[model samples]
Structures are given as structure tokens and as C-alpha cells.
Target chain A: MVKLAAKCILAGDPAVGKTALAQIFRSDGAHFQKNYTLTTGVDLVVKTVPVPDTGDSVELFIFDSAGKELFSEMLDKLWESPNVLCLVYDVTNEQSFSNCSKWLEKARAQVPGTSLPGVLVGNKTDLASRRAVDPAQAQAWALGQGLECFETSVKEMENYEAPFRCLATQFLHLYREKVELFQGLV
Target chain B: KMKTDLCLSSEGTEVILATSSDEKHPPENIIDGNAETFWTTTGMFPQEFVICFHKHVKIEKLIIQSYLVRTLRVEKSTSKEPVGFQQWIEKDLVHTEGQLQNEEITAHDGHATYLRVIIQSAFDHFASVHSISAEGTVVLNSS
Candidate 1:
């Protein structure tokens, strides 16, 4: 089985459940902290996910960066040559969803001359009663941006693994494409 | 005593070893004293490089310019050879994002012939050290 490694960046506005989603995925829902300490810098976490029906696996190095506007410029350094992007947004906050485009632009700006594979995550799905962004609208935007969309809720452990699994699968596809191109050259 | 750039590559100071070396960003860039030129890491965490001074010197302070660096550990050795290292300073730096991490650390220590820097962790996969300048006076004592 082939093993691959990909650098995945989780980015969105502050308090949009970016950290919570990442923590839930990293700890496998074993730990969830109530108190929220603002992420001042980038937090690194690694997780390996097996592609469905495939013996291969992809180890994702997730770079969870702070969503504060003050730290936006810092994203340039932290987002260097990212293999995959997880653009997160709060379901209840309209502004957070609106800012997804800005975050995507920033992430794309880091790697010029190449298209980056990414996913748009509308987090806090458990807050459906207070949701401000309609799922159809978010999904439409994600599709326009050429990204697969997923909804997750760390509090409910709802679809928390879908986004990561999608990234791992896509990275494996990218790796295989590269190998094929090199083989054709030879 | 006049202060000089102790780690200047042009002055004949050498980088004895670097754990990871990229062809575009060589370890010599760390001592080049040019902020534009930088040395970048190619591998995992805990990357390091050793710099040998022309002679034993008292280090008063150090200024490091880098990008994506998180925790840095500095060690010094006074042996005739590049062995026997003692921890001199350890710092957890604040991330500045798009800008370079310009860190000025006070390193008051006795004469030492070698210095090693360990990059414990970075905010990203790769970290870059643009320049490292040591402001200090050379030791003239024969003993």
C-alpha cells in the first residue's frame, strides 16, 4: 500500500469552530474543551486516514491557523505550498461565511501558478435553529469555487470525518497523477 | 571593544553541519548577513545547524530573522573541536505571519568557539532562517 503525506490548512474567521472541528478529528472525539483560548498562531496536528476500498493511506499535517484579522498576514507564511485547504465557516454567522472567499483568496495567493484542491466546511451544524447561511446557498458557492462542501458539528460529532477523508482521497489522486506523469516521461 | 558580525561567511566563518539542506537555500545563507538570502528547511521537526567562529568570543547578543519559526534552542561549545555543547538559550517566538520573525535575544556568555541552533518546531511544514547576526567582542586572553 502506498503512503502519502499532505499539508492541509484549516482556515476561517475566529470562533467559527475551526479549532473544535480539528480537535475533534485529531482526538477522535475523545476530548473536547469548553473554554476557548484564541489561537494566536498556527497549531499543527497530524492525522492519517485510510481511503475507502483502497489499502493506501494519507497522513495529513493539518495547520490550524488563527482566524483573527490581525493574524491574516501571518497566513501567507503558514499557508506556504499547502497541498489541500479546509476553508471553514460558522453556520450561524453570515459574516464568517461571507469571508470564506477572502480566506480562499489568501490561501490561493500563497501558491501561485497552480490550482489547490480544497473543501468548504460549514461547521456548527447542530446550531441549525440559529443558522444564518442556507445550506443550498453555501453549497452553490462552494461549487462555484470548485470545492466540495460538507457540514459538520463538533458538539454532535456529526460528519466530522468527511472533510478530512475527502482531502486524503484527493491527495492520493494527486500523488497517482504525478507518478503517472513521471512514468510517461520515462 | 568593537562589535562585529561573528557569523559572517565572507569573513571565513564556517557552517560545519546542517541537518537539512536545500539547493536553493543553503546553510551559508544563515551567515551571509543578508536579510534577502535565507536558509530553508527540507525535512521534519528539530532541524539544526552548527556554526564555528574564527576564535573564542564573548557573545553579548544575537538577532535572528526568520519565517514560520516557533520554538528555537541555542547551544554553545567552547571545545577546540565542534563538540561538548551546553544550552545557552531557549525561546518560544511569536508568529508574525507574512513578515519575517525578527528576534533579538540577549546571550551573555563566556568565550565560545562554536554555536548550534536547533529549530524545535515551526508554524508550518518548512521554516526559513534569513539571517543571524552576533553582536559581541572577540576574546584576546591567551589562557
Candidate 2:
């Protein structure tokens, strides 16, 4: 049995669906709107997913971090965990999308020397008319950062599984590449 | 062994505020073998209650059993206005399971005369005192 560990960082502006995105991905169809009261410190959750090839499961620990200024100090500690990072933004709110770069920069600075794999998520895609962020702009930003970009709707449960699974797939690919390179080294 | 004569008159439990200026409403500790004690009828001030230590001690935690009282505030002895003291005090919401145990702490400067428990706010239900326990190591502060 493969015992793989995964941790994903949900980062973006406050009230940008970072928490909603994580919950929807973790528990499919479990839609809820708890009080938007700002997350005081860090809220963490974990889910286990199965790997088809080995019939084994990997634990995915998700950190729904606070996006407020008070959490700046904690940002550094958040990056030390070895896992994929989901830089989430609100599709309906352009300001959240614009602030993605700052979140990524702060996360990268936390783990200065490690190669981090991450994805950009434009959330709340169900609200097309209210969208303040343009898809093209988000895609350009993702391409520039060498990361995959995805637009998701947690409320509608649309494309929720794809983005998280995409991160898992990328992790496997990265692991395989490292193994191959190490084999050649021997 | 001691012999004593006892008399009983069916008087209902009397309840009054702990802050009554009248000596008749003075708070008294319920003793194990004594006349049945009555509950305080009057409500605690928005921020006022008296504290009496059984013995000299440094209080570490104080648990408050209240009912329908939603908010709490405590004030230092010198300050007239009540300041929020809920954050500094560590507590568990006793009211979570349909029971009431909302807690708060009064300012405990080295020199504290009256440790007051204030009722900042309340809900539809009247607040009732179930129990209040103070835990701390005994120290020689007062004779």
C-alpha cells in the first residue's frame, strides 16, 4: 500500500472562496455558508484519496489559511509542508484575482530553496455576469508563473474535482521524474 | 455530641441581588448543615458582583454557571467603566449543550477588594446562577 502525504495551501484575499473551494473539493456536494466571520488563525482539514494503480490511498491535508494582514507571520510556516499549493481567487471579484501574485510571492518566500508545485484557481465561476476577473488575464498570469490555471464553482460543484485531482496528478508526475533522474544518477 | 432544637416554617426560597445596599440582601455562603438557603432574587449588575475567598489564594481559574446571559464584561477596581475581559479569561461554553455555563473574569490586580462579575447582556431567558467555583493555590495574602 502506498502511503503518500499531500498538503494544499488555499491562499487568496479574504472572502474570496478559498475556504469554500477547499470544502467543495474535499466533500463533494456538501455546500454550506457558515458565518463569514474572519478566520482568526489557521483552519486545517484532511481528506484521503485513492490511487487507482496501487489501490492505495494518500492523505490530503488542506490548510484553509486566513487571508488577513494578521496572518502574515504564519504565511512563512505554511510553505514548509511538502504538498501542492492552490492559489485560489474569486472569479466574481477581480480584486481577489489581482492579489494572487502577492499571495504566491509570500508563499514562495517561506520555502526559499525548494521547488514548489502549485495551481491558480479562479473560483465562483457559476456567477458569470458578476465576474470581475477576465479568464484570459488569469490564464496569462498562470502561464507567466509556470502554473496551471483553472476556473471553478464550489457552489455549483462545477470543475471542483478537476483542479484538486490535477494537482494530485502533477505530484505523481513530479515524483516519477525525480525517481527517473535519481536512477540515472546511479 | 451537641444537642440543638430546630424549628421549621415553610418559607419559600428567597432570591435577591448580591449588590443590595440593604444588609437584609447580604450574600451568605451556603453551609452544609444550616437552614435551607435561598437563591438571590435580584439580578447581578451590568458589571457588578462581590468575591469572597474562603482562604487567601491566588486564583487561576473561575467558572461561572449562568443562564440566558449572552455577554460578559469585567472592570478593574479603579476603572468605573467595564472593559471586555472575556478574551483574557480561558473558558468553555457550558451553554453549548442546552446548558448555561458562559464565563468571564474580573480584573485581579495584586490588590483587589471586590472581584465583580458583570452581566453585559442577556437573552430572553432570565440568568440563573447554578454554580461558581474558583480554583487556585492558597497563599498568605490576607489574615
Candidate 3:
């Protein structure tokens, strides 16, 4: 079985729960951040997600970055050559949801020539009463921008793995396509 | 259209993990592109060293310069990290009297990020691997 590692950038607005989502995913929902900790720079976490039915796995080097611009220069050192992206937003904050475009643009600009596989995630859906970003709207925008979309509440630990699984699936597809070229040699 | 040396230390490839290490003979010698410097196994059989490329590469062939290596095995991992290895190639070397045993193996495999070369058994108690080189092209992608 081929286990491929890809760089996954977790980016969104501050307080959008990108860190919580990543922590929950890594810890298997065993722990949640009780207090909001200001992420000053990039926190790297590696996890392997098994590709369903393929016996292959993608090791995600998830670089969870701070949303604040004060660390842009420092973040760039870790953000270079990202393989996949997870742009997160709070369903209760429209501004956070809209900023997904800018976050994605910044990620793509790091490596300009090639296509980056990514996903748009609408986080904090447990606050359904304060929902400001429509799921259908987010999904439509994601489709137009060639990104898959999903909604999850990391606070409630619901549907947190879908976005990462989606990214892994896309990367696995790219690996298979590239491997096909080498198959012709032998 | 052009093939490059994928195992050169000057080309961003490094020996991340190795089973044995000697002060005079380190695993880095395997990719240093110099056949004079070599990594010698201190003891026992089944010694291995892992080579990590800058990125996933489609190798055309792998060449190893060693002495007294009887059975050698090669494993490949596509993961960005050194994990999830699947067996790729295993070869029995042609032992030499006092000369270096040079074995060249071809590639009929997919893209690889790390290659683990295991020296399962040797003709002598200690074996030395001078260098290893892979002729391939890098798979260019954003990730």
C-alpha cells in the first residue's frame, strides 16, 4: 500500500474554530479546547487518513496557521508548497465565510504554476440559531471555485473529518493519475 | 525528456533514517555521489537506510555500489513522510573477491517519496555500501 504525505493548510478567520477542528481531528475527538488560545504562528500536526477501499493512505502534514496577519512573514515559511487546503469559516459570521476567497488566493499564490486540491468548510454549525452563511450558497461558491464544501461543528465534534477525507480523496486521485504515466515504463 | 540523478545529496535528497551509523562511515555517503566514501554495517544482517527525495519521483532505475552484499531488498513509500512502505524489489547480488559489487535495478513502479534499502544478508560479517543513485524525473505538483 502506498501512503502519501501531503501538506494541508488549515486557514480561516480568527475564532472560526479552525484550530478546534484540527485538534479534534488529531485527538480523535477526545479533547476540545476549553479556552480560545490565540495561535501565534503555524502549528504542524501529522495524521494519516485511510483512503476508503483503496488500501492507500494520505499522511496529512496539517499546518494550522494563525488567522492574524502579524505572522504573515513567518507563516509563509511553513506555507510554501502546500498540497491541499482547508478554508474554514464560522457559519455565524458572514465576514469569516466571505474571507475564504482571500485565504485560498493566498494559498495558491505560494505555488503559482500547478493546481491545488482543496475544500471549503463551514464550521460551528452547532450554533444553528446564529447561522449566517447558507450551506447551499457556500457549496455553490465552492463548486464555482473548483473546491468541495462541507459543514461541521467542531465544538460539538460533528462531521469534522469529512473535509479532510475529501481532500485526501482528491490527492489520492492525483497520485493515481501521475502513477499511470510511470506504469507505461515497466 | 531529460533524466536526472534523483539520489544526489546536492539535489535535496537526504538520508533521514538508517539502521547503522559509524563516525567514519555514515549513511549520508550513500547519496554523496562519491563512491570512495561508504557506509559500513557495524554488525548483523538486515541493515536498512531510507532516502527521501525532495518530492515524489518516478524512477527509471536504481543503482547500488556495495561489497559483500548477498541479498538486498528495496521498498518504496509514496507518503510525504517515511511510512506505509510496500515491498518493491529484491535482488541477490553477485559476490566479488575483492572488487565492489555493482548491481543496477530497473523501475517498474509508481511515484515514490522515500526508498528503504535493506541489506538482508551479506557474504561477509561486515558490508559496505559505497553509494546509491536513481535515474528519474520529479513529479511536479503544487503539493
Candidate 4:
């Protein structure tokens, strides 16, 4: 089986659980940060995700970055040529959700003219009492922007792996298509 | 173990795509085994070029000769297509002014039918790749 390495970029608004979700997934929900500190340049993590039935795996080199232009010029260097994207936002904050478009635009600018396989993550779902971004509304917008939508609460330790698994599966699907296209050319 | 120069044009390796294509300096210069002739980037820091080996090869090592490039990333695809390329290696090159930056990298047994070389960032506005030579073995699979 082929083990491919892909550069996965994690981007979102500040305090939207980008770091928490990433740490949880990397440690298989075992390690969660108690105190939140501002992410400076970039946090690089490597995880191997197996494609379910295909027997292949994608080694994701995740570049979890800061939110909303925090030392953004330095971020541009780390954000180059992302193979997969995870755009996160807080469910309790409508303003953070609204800024998804801007985050997406910035990520896409790194690799111009390329369709980046991405997922829109609505984080902090446990904050239902303060939920501002509607699930259905976020789903519709994600669909319109060619992104798969998934809502999860890192604090609640629920469904954190779904978005990453979806990205791994999607990357494998793209690989299969390329193999077919090359075989067709032969 | 035998080592083969997998990036040679004589070995059926062809450069399929390049972000910068100058009339005088072409992308094919990288595989021609001549350091004097080179492929120069036109406008940006993240310029790239694709080299198709036409078959699956497990690249053991790669030697790249370039100028002014600071950060370089290499990706590959087993499908031999322009699509589905995945990251293989990335390096932060040290710039020594007035000379070519010769980088030799170990591939960690990277297998690919096509390889993409990306100049992610550079010390200057433009960078030139003098040559790229890879040592590897070809695998034959019929599936």
C-alpha cells in the first residue's frame, strides 16, 4: 500500500478551538490543553490516517496556524501549497463563522488555480446555549463553497476525527481518480 | 545495489509542466545534465515544475543545483498524472552569494511516477535551477 504525505493547513478565527481540536486528534483524544496560549508562528504535527477500505494511508503534516491575520506575513511562508484544508470557527460566535470566507480566500491564495480539498469545522458545539451559527446555514454555505461541513466540540470530545477522516478519504479518492486518468492515457 | 540516474532525459524522464517557461531557458534544462544551462523562475517565490518518469521509481537520493532559492519543497504522484501530488520533502536552503547552492537530499525511499519541484521561497526575486539528478530504482507492476 502507498503511504502518501500531504500538507494539511488548519486555519480559523482566534479562540475557535483550532489548537484544542488538533491536539485531541493527534493524541487520539487523550491530550487536551488546560490553558490556552496564543499560537505564534505555526504548530506542526504529523499524523498517519489510514483510508478505510483502500488499505492506503495519508501522512498528514498539519500546519495549525493562528487566526485572523495574527502575524500573518510569517504565516504566508508556512501556508504554501496546502494539500488539504480545515477551516474552523466557533459555533457560539457568529462573527467568527462569518469570517470563514475570508480565511478560505487567504488559504486559496497560497495555491492559486488549484481546488484545495477542505472541510468547514464549526467548533464548540457544546456551547449550544450560546450557539449563533446555525448548523443548516453553515452546511449550506459549505456546500456552496465546495467544502464538506462538520460540527464538533473539542471540549466535549465529540466527532473531532470526522473532519480529518473525511479529508483523508477525499485525498484517497482524488488519488484513485488520478491513477485512472493516467491509465486512460496509456 | 545499483544506482540509476532517474532524472535524465535519456532515461525517458520528461518535464511536463512548469510555472515559468522562458523562450531561452526551458524547464528541460534541469534534466539535461548541464549546469550552465538552467531553468529560471519568472515572477513569484512559489514557482514549480513537474518531471514525469513515465514509470514508478523509488528515489533513494536527489541532488539539486540551484541559485537564490531559500525554501524548496518536493512532491510526488504515483499516478503519473499532474493531479494527486503529495508532499515528499521540504528544505530550507542556505544562500551563499555569488555561487550555486548545491543541495543533496535523501528521499526516505520515496516512490513516484511523477515528481514536482516547488520553489516555495527565495532570497531574491528570481531563482534558477541548474540541474536535478536523482538516483533510484524502477519498479514493474501490472495492476
Q: Estimate each model's TM-score.
A: 0.55, 0.49, 0.56, 0.57
i-RMSD of all predictions: 11.9, 32.8, 16.8, 15.6
- Candidate 3, superposed: residue stretches over 4 Å from native: A29-41, A67-69, A184-186, B1-143
Model 2 vs truth, CA RMSD = 19.9
Off by over 4 Å in 2: A29-41, A51-57, A66-69, B1-143
The 0-to-1 C-alpha lDDT of every candidate, in the order given, reads 0.79, 0.53, 0.80, 0.80
If the candidates were sorted by their TM-score against the true structure, best first, what order would they fall in? 4, 3, 1, 2
RMSD of every candidate to native, in Å, equals: 10.7, 19.9, 16.7, 13.7
lDDT at position B3, candidate 3: 85
Clashing pairs in 2: B15-B39, B15-B40, B15-B41, B16-B40, B16-B41, B16-B42, B17-B42, B47-B118
Candidate 3 similarity to native, TM-score:
0.56
Residue B72 lDDT, candidate 2, scale 0-100: 55
Give the per-residue lDDT of model 1 (tens digit) for B62-105.
Answer: 99988768899999998878999999999999977567788999
lDDT of 2 at B70: 55
Per-chain TM-score (chain B), model 2? 0.49
Q: Provide the lDDT at B53 for model 4.
A: 89
CAPRI level of candidate 1? incorrect
In candidate 4, what are the lDDT values of residues B1-143, reduced to their tens digit? 46799999988889999887655568898899887777776433478999988888889999998886889999998884678988999999997666778899998958888899999976643567889999888885323
lDDT of 2 by residue, B2-72 (tens): 21111111111112225422132233321111322212212222423544432233455555555444565
Per-residue CA lDDT of candidate 1, range A24-83, in tens?
888874232222333555567777788998887777788877454456567667777687
Which prediction has more favorable DockQ, 2 or 3?
3
Location of the lowest summed lDDT over 10 successive residues in candidate 3 chain B: B37-46
For the second chain of model 4, what is the TM-score against the true structure's chain B? Answer: 0.94
- Select the stronger candidate by TM-score from 1 and 3: 3
